[model samples]
Target chain A: MIALEVKKMKKNFGGVKAVDGLSLKFEKGQITSLIGPNGAGKSTMVNLMTAMYPPDAGKMIVHGVTLEKWKSYNMPTYGVTRTFQDVRLFEQMSVLDNVLVVLTERGVFRSLFETHGELHLKQAEEILKRVDLWKKRDEKAEDLSYGQRKLLEIGRAVAMDADIYFFDEPFAGLFKEMVKTVVSILHELKNNGKTILLIEHNMDLIRELSDHVIVVDAGKFFAEGEASDVLARKDVVEAYLGE
Target chain B: MDYIMHLSVLVGVYAILGLSLNLVVGYSGLLSLAHAAFYGVGAYGSAILMKDFGFSFLSAVVLSVLITMAVGVLIGLVLSKFDGDYYALASLGFSVIAFGVFLNWRDLTNGAFGIFGIPKPEIFGYKFLAGEPYAFLVLLAVIFTFLICYFVVNSSFGRVLKAIREDEKALQVFGYKTTLYKLAVFVISAGLAGFAGTLYGSYISFIDPGGFDDLVSVNLIVVVILGGLASLNGSLLGAAFFVLLPELLRFVGMPDSITGQMRQMIYGLGLIALMMYRPQGILGKFRL
Candidate 1:
């Protein structure tokens, strides 16, 4: 089943077309890796789909709900959430709070009356343990190391419990053990039948993890298919492989 | 004894002001200089309601706080569009505008003549006319404000404010309408500041446009920063220093003419030194 579909999306920054007339499909329960060279608009596509930046023109159909315009603040309510290319966590907040906040009461009336209780703490801890961050649950996010910050960001996204998770470079920099932890988390998420869209450069990891690959060049589609088939394309090699 | 009671009441009122500003500057991370404007609105609103309409103390205060909140929301909507230094400047402009209104809107505010003969707070049938009794009342207000700040900051709603301060876009992606959150804090802060204003107006039994201006707003901001950004106790500590330091200087025997100028200079130097040595302020956890 299709989780999200993008049709004729166009976005431009100044004179540059970041994402130009791009049409794409994200399937449910599948890990789709978006691969491209530098400035291939991989991240821009995520921005447009997530409504971080409004597309000059586009249509996003999520679970058959057609949306001509997507408001960035409505994503979580729509059951969509994303992680940043640069890990963005509440720096001053405790590691546990970073996750608990996502699960906390969101409505103003309820927020004032309700507090973070045992259920919220238990869930936050579970997500933290999944990322092996339960030990540092009380530490501020800014004090975490580079790799830990990435894990925390992932942990926060996991805490959101959103249906569609767009991870922008979740595995860019990490130790082998941390990478394994993330790989396991993603595998578990996939096993749970969650839709995952990842933007990554590591071909080996892409081959190992991705169920499908979509290649883009200069803000336009280059090729897309099964990992083996798309990665074998001559144009994809010329554009992305720097051949 | 009366002198000390009066001084303590001043501290209590300023402490309430500090806590109110801290909610915006410390917890929510918005540097707002327009706090005293809301403070003034509360004072003037209560003063007018009670003096002209013969309203009870409780009714007047509640109405003034509500009026201040309405104004706060209007200003917050505009301030929400700007961030960082721009946000500060826009707020400063609002403070200036509010001051202008207070100074020139004579028909309501009474302008330079100021409002006087404001009655003491009377609840039920008992009138709180004594200095110690009023001081106790002010202390109660301080405790109430502190408790509200404590619970709100510790809640998840407060966590989201910190998140917005860190990365607004990221919070929005998580489906948080940052504008509403910002506005909420702004209105709450304003309402509390208005409460403090009412306390001040009732305590002093008089108020003027001069009491709420750029200098007063800057003084409140200074108290928030010095006590420490994002620290509730820092607000109390800041209020202590802000309210008492000048009073202490009055006894230094320096001429009153130069004393005012000298005290301001000292405050500037102290702030500069604090920034150099402890940019985080005395107990600040976060730095602007």
Candidate 2:
């Protein structure tokens, strides 16, 4: 089943069309890599999809239901979660608290009295261990190394347990071991029937991991298909070199 | 003994103010300058209900808090549109407007003459007279406010507040209605400030528009900063220090004319030193 579908999505910032007439679909339990050169509106597409910026015109259908007047905060309720291109972790909070915060009850009154119980602790521990940050769980997020910070951000997304995970440049500025760790996480998420929309620049990693590929350049669709076919296209190669 | 009790009562009142404002400025990372407005509303609201309408103390306090909370919701809705320095500026503007109303509303507030003859709190036929009885009463209020702040900061809701403080946009992506959280904390903080105002009015037996001005709000911010941002104990310590310091300066024996100026100088210099050395405050874990 198609987990998420965007049709005729358009967004503009003054004279610049950040994301214009973009349409894409991702199926459940599949990994779709969204690739483009710099200034290709890749990040803007993710932002629009996650409702961080309202599209000037479009329709977003998730789980066969059309979302009307959806907001950024409502994305999680619709089983949508995302990581930023620049890792945005709760810097003053501990690694464990970062994950635990995502597991918190959203109801204001109920959460006012709610403490993190054993189940929350267990879930947090599981996520931290998976990210290999269990030992640094007590350390403040700001104190973590860049790669570790990236892991914590992903761990936070895992704690959300949402269906569609938008990993925007999740592999940026990471060591080889950390990259492998993230690769395994993406695979694990896919195995569990989660839809992953990954925005990445690494051609080899995209070729190795993507079940499907979609390319955009200057806020418009350039090419898309199997990763092997799309990456080899003359126009697609020129788009990257042209930039 | 009476003097000590009076000082203790002042400390207790300010402590409650500090704790309430801490929720907004410390945990939620919204620097609010309109706290004293709600504080004034509470004092004026409760004082009027009891003195004019002959309502009981408890009922007056309850109704006053509700009224202040309603005002808070209205103010919070407007404040939520701005962030950082703009939020602070807007809050200061609201506080100025509130003071203007207190000074200009002659019929309801008695104008610059202020409200007098605010009766001491009476519970179960026992009047909490000034001095020891009222001190004890205020002590109870301090403890109550402290526990409320403690429970709130320790809860999952508090965690989200800290997250909101760190990065509101990121928290929104996590499915938290951040504006709602911000509004909730703002209203709660306003209600608590109003509660403190009620306590102050009853203890002092008189309140003027002079008591709830923008300067008073700045002093409350000092109380929070000195005590420590995001630290409950810091609020108490900050309030105690704030209330006691001027009294201590009395023994310095400078000329009476310069004495007030001297106290102001000392307060300013001490805060500057604190910021330079320990910006987080005495017990604060977070620095703005």
Candidate 3:
């Protein structure tokens, strides 16, 4: 079944159309990759999906309701979670606190006086262990190596229990081992029937990891279908690999 | 001997001030320019109550703290909508309004003539009035408040605040409503600032609108930044310097005319230099 459907989505910055009549379906339990050249509006699409930016005209159905109609805090209702192009972790907080932050139950007044419960702490510990960051959990997030910070953020997302995971350039700047850590996590996620939409420039990774692919060039979908076929297209190659 | 006692009490007062401001400015990364307003609120809230209602010191102090904090929460709700220098401006507006209250609320606040004769705090059978005995009480309260801050900053709740400071969006992705956290921190900080004001009022037995000006707010900022943002120990050191430096001006042999202006200039200059030399502050090893 379609887990997320974008119907005639359009976003504009002043006169510039960042997302122009974009329409796509993300299925539950499939790994989908949105690939495009630089400035191809990949990040903009992610932002629109996350409700960070509202489309000028569009409808997004997440888990059956139009996400646009829901409040900003309920974006997670779509079971969606995402990361930034640049890693954003609480700088002064210990690495463990990063994941623990996500694990805490949030409400307006209750969470303020509420401390992290045992379950939350357990969940954070479990995720950190998976990311191999349990050892460094006491260290500040900013003190981590580039690779570890990315892993920590990924761990935080993992603890969020989002059904539809939007990973924005999850493998960017990661070392080979860290990339494997991420890939393995994705594999585990897909095996458990979690929907994932990945934004990536690495064609090789897209071909290997994605079950489906869509190519956008200059704010419009230039190509779609099997990753192998799309990567071989003249337009896709021309946009990324150059003439 | 009296000067030494005053120095310690002053240190205790500003230390509480610095710590309260630290909750917002340091940990939460909110540049609050209206802290002095809340500080004023606490002072005036108690002042008016004690002066007109003839309330005892204990009741007046409690009422003042609550009233100031209530005002603080309202301002926090509004300030929560803004950040960076914009948040600063919002706080600045609150400070200005508080000043207006101090000036225009004539019958209650004595119309800028100020509130005097604020009785010493009477708790149980013990009394905290002038002299070393009162200084000890201030010291105890300051220690208690600072300990609370230290614990809060080290707790998971405080980490969430720091996270919001680092990247508000990051907190959202992890499924947090950062606006709520920011407002919570603001209210807490404001309440502590009000508590400081209550102590100030009871100690000095006098207060007026002039004390809660924008410059006072700036001075608190100077203290935090100098101590270093997000560092509790650094804030204490900064508070000590801020409260005692004016007293030290006597030793420096500067003329009385230049004393106030020169001390303020030094505070401003010192903050700038610290931000330049060690943007992290004296003990802030982490960058937010």
Candidate 4:
């Protein structure tokens, strides 16, 4: 079953076509990877799907709902969450606070004086432990090591418990153990029947974790399919592996 | 002795003012220039309720806080659509409009003549008259407001505000509605400013339009950023600087005319220095 459907999508920055009439489908509970040469519309598609930038002309269907039906909520409201290529956390805030912020209920009708209940603290603790950041919970996010900051942001999104997860180059700067930890998390989330979008350059990690693959050049979908089948294509092979 | 009493009350009032503004600019990362308007609203709101409606002092302050919060909600609705420089300008416009209303609406606000003869608050048979007792009253209110803001900004909600400040887009992708959080923090910050306004009106025994110029707004920011942007204790330090500057001027035999302008210049110079050297202010913990 298709979890995400993109059709006739186009995105242009001034005169540059970052995503040119791209179309693709993501299957339910599948780990999809987007791989291509530099300047591919891979991240643009992810941003569009996440509703960061309004689509120039396209239709995106998520969970059997068309673009019209999905118009009610932006990226955040659609139960979609992501991590940036550059790790961004509330630097002055503690590592625990970074994840804890996600657990907050964004309800404004509630009085300003109302406090966060015990459940929020519990969830924050669980996510921090998952990222092995519980020990450094009190430390400022800025004070964390490079890899730890990445893990902290990942922890925040994972703790967010969104329906669709987008990891934009999650493995770019990770150490081996940290990479292993994230790889295991991807499998765990996939095992639990979640949709995952992996935007990465590490072919090994992509092959290991992605159930499906997508290739974009410029702003258009070049190809997409089962992870093995797509990666086997000559064009994808040439563009990525340069064989 | 009389000057010291008045000074103490002003310090306490500015302390509350600084703390209220802190909730917006410090925690929520909003550059709100309309805090003094809400501060004015609070002062005038409580004054009207007590003098016209014949409500008790406590009830009047309570009503004023609620009314200011309602106004905050309205501003939040407009402000929720804006961010960065536009947000600051919009808030400043609000302050300007409110001051205009206070000046023109003579029947309600007595125009520039303003509301006078506001009686001291007497709660539960304890009178908060002028001098030491009143200073004590204002101090307690300032302390209470400080503690409340401190506690909230340290809580989970406060953390989310920081998140919104740091990375609104990242938070949005994380399924957190950044707009709602922004509005929530705005209303909270404005409400606290209104609370300070109530104290200001009672402490001064009067309310007027000129008292709420943009300079007052600038003064509030002066304290918050000078003391430290996000430190809970920074508000107090800011309040001290604002309240003590004039008295310190008296010691140096500076004339009143030059003292006021000199103080303003000092504030400007201090802000520039802080932004250049220590953007985080004194505490240097939460850099905006």
Candidate 5:
């Protein structure tokens, strides 16, 4: 079943067409890799889908419901959540609190009086352990090393427990072992029947992890197929090589 | 001893102001300079309701807070469109406008003549006269305000506020209505400031536009920054320092001719030195 569909989306910045007439579909319970060369509107596409920026013209259908006048803050209610291309953790907060923030009550009045109960703690602990940061949960996010911060960001995403997850350059600066941890997390999300839209530049990891791949260049679709098939295309090579 | 009690009352009033303002400036990272306007609204609102409308002290305070919160909502909606320096500038403008109203609104506020002979608070047939009784009333108010701030800072709402301070955009993608949270804190902070204004006006028995000017809002900011940005106890400590420091300088016995001017210089120097060495303040976790 199609989990998310973007039809003829258009976005412009001044005279530049950041995301001009783009279209794509992401299926449920599958890992789809969105690959592109530099300045390919990959991040812009994620932003549009997540409602960070309103599209100039397009329709987004999630779970067969057309999104009309949606906002970034309400996207999670639609079971959509995303991580930033540049890791954006609450820096001064503790690692545990970072994950717990996602589990907080949404209502302003209820949240004002409600303390994080045992259920919240248990869920946070489970996510922290999954990211292998349980031991460092008490440490401030700013105090964590580069790799640990990435994992904590992932742990926060896990706490969201959304139907669709957008991971933008999740493996950008991780060590080999940390990459394994994130790869496992993607698999776990897929196993739980969550739609995964991944933006990554690492060809090997994309080939190994993606059930399907879609390529875009200069805000337009270039090619897409099973990962192995599209990555080997002549046009895809030239686009990446800038030939 | 009476002088000490008077200072103590002043401390209590400023403490409430500091705690409330910290929720916006410290926790939510909104640099609001219109706090004194809300403070004046509370003072003037209660004063008018009690003196002109013949309302009781308790009802006056309650109604004044509601009125101030409504005003806060209107101001907060406008301020919500701005962030960072623009937010601070807009809030400063509001304080100036509020001061203009207090200064020129002749029929209601009596213009520059000010309000005098305001009635003492009467609870359960017991009138709270000046000195110890008023001091005790303010102390109770301080305790109540402290508990409210403490509970708010510890709850999930406060957690979100701290996150909003760190990165509002990022928090929004986490499914938080950041604008609403910002508005909530701003209104609550304004309401609490108004609550303190009621206590201050009732205690003094007189209030003027000068008491709630932009400079007063700046002083409240200094109190919050000096106490520590995100700490409840820090607000209390900051309020104490602010209220007591200049009074203590009197004992230094600078020639009476230069006493007032000298005290101002020393206080200014002290603050500069403190900020130079400890930008985070005495107990602050975050630096402004």
Candidate 6:
């Protein structure tokens, strides 16, 4: 089932076509890797779909809701969440608080009176333990190492429990252990039927993890197919190799 | 004892102001200089209603807070459109505008001469004239304000505010309306500041536009930053330090002719030294 459908999404930044009339389908319960050259509009496409940037002319169908323009604040309500490429964690909050903030009730009035309940703490602890951040839960997020910051961000996204997840370079700068932790988390999320859209440049990991792959070059759709088949395409090699 | 009570009342008033400003500047990461504007609104609102309409002190305070909240929402909406330095500039503009109104509107605020014969606070037929009794009233106000601040900064709402402070765009991706949270804090913080303003005006039994000037607003920000951002206890400590430091200068035995100037110099040097040594502030986990 298509969890997200982008129809002719177009975005331009001052004569540079960041995402130009590109339409694609992201399937439910599957991991889809969106690969592209530097400045190939992969991140732009994610921004457009998540409503971070206004599409020059495009629309998206998310969670059965037809949106002519993507609205960033509406993403979570529609069961969609994304992690930033530059790790954006609540720097002053405790590591536990970083995840707990996302897990707490979203309602304004309810949140005002409600403390982090036992269930919320349990959920936060479970996610933190999964990311191996439970021990550092009392430390500030800024005190974490670069790799740990990335893990905490993923942990935050996990706590959101959104049906659709967008991971932007989650494995970048991570150590092998951290990478394995993230990969396992991604697999676990996929097994639970959460749709994952990853923007990554690691060709080997892309081929290994993505069930399907969407490739873009210079803001245009270059290729789309099963992961291995698309990676083997002559055009895909030339696009990456700059031949 | 009388002198200590007088100093305590002043410290309590500034503490309320510090904690209130800390909410907007520290937790929400909004540099709002217009807090003094709301503070002025409360002072003038209660003064006008009580003096002209014969309203009770408590009713006047409640009405003034409501008035400040309304004004805060309007200004907050406009300020929310901008971030970082721009937000600060826009809020400062509002503060200036509020000050201008207080200064120019002679009929309501008595203009430059200021409101005279402002009524003293009375509850249940007992008048809080002065001395320890009045100081206790101010202390009660401080306690009430602190409790409210504690409950808010500890809740999920506060967690979101801190999240908003960290990265509003990231919070937006999580489906939180960052603007609404910012605006809510603006209104809440402003209303609390206004409450403090009411207490200040009644305590002094006089008020003028000069008291709510940009310097006072800057001092409020200094309290938050000096004690620490995002720390309620820091607000109290900051306020005490700011209020008491000047008084301590009185004991330095400097000549009365240059005592004020010497005190200002010492205060400036001390702040610079503290910032150079501990940039995060005395107990701050965050910096503005």
lDDT of 3 by residue, A58-101 (tens): 88888788755444466775688888777878777789878877
Model 1: DockQ vs. true structure: 0.75
Best by lDDT: 2
Model 5 chain B: lowest-lDDT 10 consecutive positions: B259-268
* Residue pairs in collision within model 1: none
What is the TM-score of each candidate's chain B when compared with the real chain B? Answer: 0.97, 0.98, 0.96, 0.97, 0.96, 0.96
Model 6 is docked with a DockQ of: 0.82
Question: Best-fitting candidate, measured by DockQ?
Answer: 2
How accurate locally, in lDDT, is each candidate? 0.90, 0.92, 0.82, 0.82, 0.90, 0.88
**Could you report the DockQ of all the candidates, in the order they appear?**
0.75, 0.84, 0.54, 0.49, 0.81, 0.82
Models ranked on DockQ: 2, 6, 5, 1, 3, 4
The lDDT, on a scale of 0 to 1, for candidate 1 is 0.90
Return the DockQ of model 3: 0.54
> Native contacts recovered by candidate 6, as a share?
0.89
Candidate 6 structure quality by residue, lDDT tens digits, A75-132: 8888999888889898978999999888887777788878558999999999999999
lDDT of 4 by residue, A1-243 (tens): 888788888889999998898888878788988888878888887777777788888888877778742331365565677887778788888887787776766664432344665777888888888889999999999999899998988888788687778888888888999998898888888998888888998877887888888888777667778777887888779776675
All candidates: CA RMSD (Å):
1.5, 1.8, 2.1, 2.4, 1.9, 1.8
Off by over 4 Å in 4: A69-79, A109-119
What is the alpha-carbon lDDT for the whole of candidate 6? 0.88
Task: List, in order, the clash count of every candidate structure.
Answer: 0, 0, 0, 4, 0, 0
